[model samples]
Target: GCLPISIIGLLVETTHLSLVTPVGWWLLVYSTVVQFCIAYVSWFAALARLPASVAAIGTMAVPVIGVVASAIALGEPLGAGQIAALVFTLAAVVLATR
Candidate 1:
């Protein structure tokens, strides 16, 4: 799903490759291997083992986690709308599991 967009982004940003420091390159490689490769494989393996409903609820929780993580790690603001959305998402996940 993301391959095409990633390819395009890589092509577009190729000229700026010189801007990346050695540490930045290492971080990118680490993120690619850990986030894209290991995380996806682990997620799929767990999904295969879990019941459908549980897996679905777990999938739904991903965005909620992302929102909270961003708020804490990136100093991103979580206003009323985001809080409400998170509440609604949790409610839906609860309802779905039952």
Candidate 2:
């Protein structure tokens, strides 16, 4: 909770930050709030109940999930960097699960 607030404050404090357009700031805030609710809080709860290795595999799904979501939500083309991230995430999951 406090960590998330701290992270948001860091994001807001960055001079490099700027909205892509008029509504971008609103969307940024909304998405950040939603992600904090869904992923961050839920993950913390899940880790408490599950083995750390199991929890880690579940958490590592994020990059792959993001790859698919970006395709759907943003119509973004998959690039080499993303592909690499996905591969690394997959390898990590496999190693951790094994």
Give me the overall lDDT of model 2: 0.82
lDDT per residue for candidate 2 within 1-98, as digits (tens), equals 79999988898886555537758877887888987688788889888999888887766797799788998899999888878888888987887787
Which candidate number would show the highest lDDT if scored against the true structure?
1
Residue 17 CA displacement from its true place in model 2, Å:
12
Residues 1-98, candidate 1: write the lDDT tens digits. 89999899888775677889999999999998877897788778878899777777768899999999999999999999999999999998898888
- Relative to the true structure, candidate 2 reaches a TM of 0.56
**Each candidate: what lDDT?**
0.89, 0.82
Q: For each candidate, what TM-score against the reference? A: 0.82, 0.56
Error of 1 at 58 (Å): 1.7
Over the full model, what C-alpha lDDT does candidate 1 score relative to the true structure? 0.89
